[model samples]
Target: MAKAMTIPDYHPYQQAHLNKPQLQFSDIAPLIEHYQVQPWLTVTELGRSVKQQPIYQLQLGQGDKRILAWSQMHGDESTATAALFDLLNYLQAPEQAAWREQLFAEITLYIIPMLNPDGAAKHSRVNAQGIDINRDALALQSPEGQLLMAAAKQIKPHFAFNLHDQNRFHAAGPYPNPATISLLAPAYNAEREINASRRAAMQLIAHVQPWLEQQIPQHIGRYADDWSARSFGDTFAAMGISTVLVESGAYRGDDNRQMARWLNFQLYVAWLAAIASDSYQQADVALYNAIPFNRSGGMKDVLLQGLTVSIGDTTATVDLAINLALTGDRRARIDELGDLSLFSAFHQFSVQGLAFKAGQAYPLNTALSLDTEAHLALLQQGYTHFSGDKALLQASSRLPVLLNPLRPTQGSPQLWQGATFLLVNTQGKVVQAVLNGQLISVPSGVIHNPLGT
Candidate 1:
């Protein structure tokens, strides 16, 4: 009845070069430069970041229903920014003229693709001043946050979109699969009483869920709506603006979030089209409420089950939950252990009956370099890693090359330590190797991302 709400498939319509996780100002300058000259769009210098990088706003359309959307308030979150550029590229194409004209006749769009260039340059969540712009809504400390508030006051938009990237480890429900995309209609007050503004946001998210379900079934989630007074989404909702938060998370092999980026791009198109056609009024709020709440920490990247450990002169069976670190370039740590039956993992290796032990490090002088086959061979020999200067170790090796060799432990896996070790059979043959954070099957010798990030 709402004309199906089908958008062009993302893979073919994709035109943005957004396959990178750490996007900098330099990476996006070209896209902004290209859009500035487009006759159908209006570009304005909104403000500058703390490091003096220009932050621009892009505007289009002329009808009464005004909407404001922005991305990259946390510089490290750039999936939404890439999707914005991809959306712009598709909108500017002549083939979409008819749809664009019709949409423009009913609504106007104000978009900020990147709000924290300095933070982006450093691949950090905080701006150059080390202040989180998202949390600056009330304090108005960061200039980027100030610019956003000023723009909202000036525009008084009917709706707002707060775009972001959530942790890849967040799950849609009790399952191990990551919640690739999460939507939230942020609550305004402590009580979180639903008013017309919040209701509208909920209805819109409900309108998009069916289409999203078809794209990635059971992988969509609703963000926890605990009111955070300092966040723009919460404040905007308090101001009577319907604000929808779109969190682009990760997919299996999509370490760069390309899958999430494509979904974000297509989702935006669907949202604008639904607004233009008055289709959102038909959405059932119950569907939105039915969406699964995003579950966190209940899931991990890898899990080793029933491992035999020798600690305190006693042998005990345990389980370990491993997850890649977010701060470092690529490193994993043992997140937790014990029963862990309630938790789910992306990579689960049952080391039942296998004994866990500290892995031996190859001599730095003798093994300064190694090939994939040699790495696999060494893994079989209980050499989980190599010791050498990082610069001297080539990227060609799949095994982790530690600059400083780790001290020998008591042959017990320690919680919160780097996820690197070996699981050996009763015959003392290494059966599995957890390198960085990846589970490598010793028999198959299938190597995964060494950093496990």
Candidate 2:
């Protein structure tokens, strides 16, 4: 049996090349210029985007086994682009000279740093023509798509890596933890058949999983195997090339995705090392099926349970599930308001047998804008809620009160504001209060004013 391969720790090799997760083609212009001067790298302008931005391909090594990888196919997904740059930096480092030499001797790499420059600049998923390049594989409608497919056909690479970024809400299997990284071995046909090419991809993925799991236990997810001909991975697999999909996802408290970017860098280095050593050939492909599949809607940001709520004479004990909105303001929204025993949350508050009462709403003064001092004063005075005109409420204020009420829609529940809640015990004593889905200390004598009198 072949010797079991061990991935070297590449954390120390991570450089500060990328200051932020969002990268425009202009942001990497200096690095691209620097690489153009390197003797080991050959740069070529493959094509131009709809916005007339140049798309360049960097070629390295002369080995027979070719590997083609592209980043930023969806302009908004930039984690892989950062990782690829960091990988290039590592290859040129003095300490990694021997390993880099061995990798070059075994494989040639062709990398497209930013395939959709226009989308990247605007931080959008689609290109300037509003075309999703990934879905344009079969149609070959976009210039970027045409260039990618043409390059793959000309190079006839032995392997391809399709890099992307998934939604931040996805979790690993049933675990409440966010999926920091996800992998996939795309199917070659509509039936989702696995051939030798796919088997090789799976084997490689199985090899990488252990290394990733060590860094983030129960936080790695495997993408669904549904086949889409329009997708480049599936298309490449159908062309008899082994393809691996790397999707960078959310990490707890990493709003800027800096941690995910570093993880991606580590993944690329380990994968390349494995490929150079030819250890992936011995990897157990069966382990691929054992990896956890990505799951959704299993967790919430906050859960409030066992509270007795009175909604216009309808009183019932219930639970509340809240999630942060994906867009602007990141306001907490009520996902469900019933039995949420099956769900888990990062933060949980239980107030069993406590009565929920609406707090008094103090109208904001039109002449004086609400500031942190004014907001805190109201809380100290036992006023737990506030309401005002849209302009007044929209102003920057540090008040812990809901500003508006959101109604339930067909797809999502209404995210309401201004209706603060105070939970009280049977003795009419204030126990706890929630303002704008945030826990706040309630003062005495504030529990009896359920009608906001």
Candidate 3:
């Protein structure tokens, strides 16, 4: 009888060189050259993108079972590409010789690090032809799509890994935590039936779920099983190959997704080990089904609850939900107002008995500047609002004030300027306030403000 192969700890082998969240084809060119000289790896030009950028594939191991993995199908989603390179770095390290030998003896690996180099270079989601390669899998209209299909035909892999990144809004289950990582065994048919291929994929996911749960706690999300004939994952599964979809999502406090990259490397090693040792077969597919599905619209960046507002004759109490828009700039906007009881918040404030007032009017000729501290000082004084140049308002970070230059009607304050909500408690005392989706503290006591205003 043979002894069980012990899976090595992945922490020591984790590649620390690639830490950035964004990557491009040019960024990996040097690394590719470095790997070309290795004795155990075979580097080949799979094809070229619409922009004439070379798409390369790296092949390693000499095992009987074959596995195919690709990353950066969408150019903007570069985290998985970073992880694949990290994995390559680990595989070529002299210290991992024993583990590499065992893995190579049991399975052969084929990897396409950046399938859509054209889109990657421009930081776009689609190829240079403005077509999404994943959706073009069956059409084969795009060169990248055609190249991927050709590679799949030549490798005839037993298993496939489709890697990508998702938006930060997704939550793990319905919990407050963000979905740090998500996985899926794509459905093979429109009926969403589970065949041998999908079953195998599910079992592998099940085997990795426990370890991932231990690592991320309530941050693992099992992607919903949706069958799309044009998608590569479903199409490959329908072709009788076990396919797994891995989506890197946002983790708390790690905006660059560096932590997500490390987690991806860990997952790759675990999946490869399970396949090489046949340990995935022992895993229960039901466990995969049991993993929580990703949910959306659960929480916002900031929330203000219970305030009375008067615009001339009408007065009403409302709650406000504010969110930060990711436009490579510092600008927070009011996403919703009025009863937002269904939603959760990263930062919440209560002003149950406070009277709210909008910002005061500023002269049109007033000189505007990008002084954040000066703007915040104005808020600290009694003025709740100020209308000025859009550029200066958008550039200021110290100002806890909203921008609404349009100055909409009182009832419909859609784009009202300096839309700060001054919260005055009963007995005519100003207790707390909300500015530009952030809460501020008054002399009476501190309000629950996450932005530290």
Candidate with maximal TM-score: 1
Candidate 1 vs candidate 3: the TM-score winner is 1
lDDT for each residue of candidate 2 in 1-453, tens digit (9 for 90 to 100): 111233255555555656565789988888889888998889998989999999999998777788999999999898888888878887888877787778888889999989999999998999999999999989999999999999999999989999998877677887878788889999999899888999989988888777677778988899899989899999999999999999898776566676777777776766676777777888888778877998866566667789776666677888877665544455555667789887766566787888766555667667446665555555555455555665655435443545544431212123443224566778766666655556654443232212111
Which digits, one per residue and each the tens of the lDDT, describe model 1 over residues 1-453? Answer: 243345545555565566787788888898889889989989999989888999999998987888999999999999998888888877887878998888889889999888999989888899999999999999998999999999999999989999999987788875567899999999989899999989999988999888888888888888889999999999999999999999998777678888898888877887888788778979999989988998986568787889898777898888888867756645677788788887777777788999887787776664345677777788787787666656666546645544453433226777777778888889989887877777777867665544424
**Which residue pairs clash in candidate 3?**
359-384, 359-385, 404-416, 404-417
Q: Please, what are the lDDT tens digits per residue for candidate 3 over residues 1-453?
A: 011123355556555555665788878888889888889999999889999999999999999989999999999898998889888877888877898999999999999998998898877899999999999979999999999999999999999999999887777887777788989999999899988888999998998887787778988888888789999998999999999999998876676787788888877887888899998999998889888998876666666777676677988788777665543444556677788776666666776777775545443344466355555555556555655555544345444444543331233334322234556666655555565555776643233554422
Q: What are the TM-scores, per candidate, against the unseen true structure? A: 0.92, 0.84, 0.85
Model 1 alpha-carbon miss at residue 73, Å: 0.3
Please give the distance, in angstroms, between residue 223's alpha carbon in candidate 1 and its true position after superposition: 1.7
lDDT of candidates 1 onward, in order: 0.83, 0.76, 0.77
Ranking by TM-score: 1, 3, 2
Candidate 1, number of clashes: 0
Off by over 4 Å in 1: 1-5, 326-329, 364-380, 387-398, 401-403, 406-410, 448-453
- Runs in model 3 with CA error above 4 Å? 1-17, 307-317, 328-330, 348-351, 354-356, 360-373, 382-453
Ten contiguous residues with the weakest lDDT in model 1: 401-410
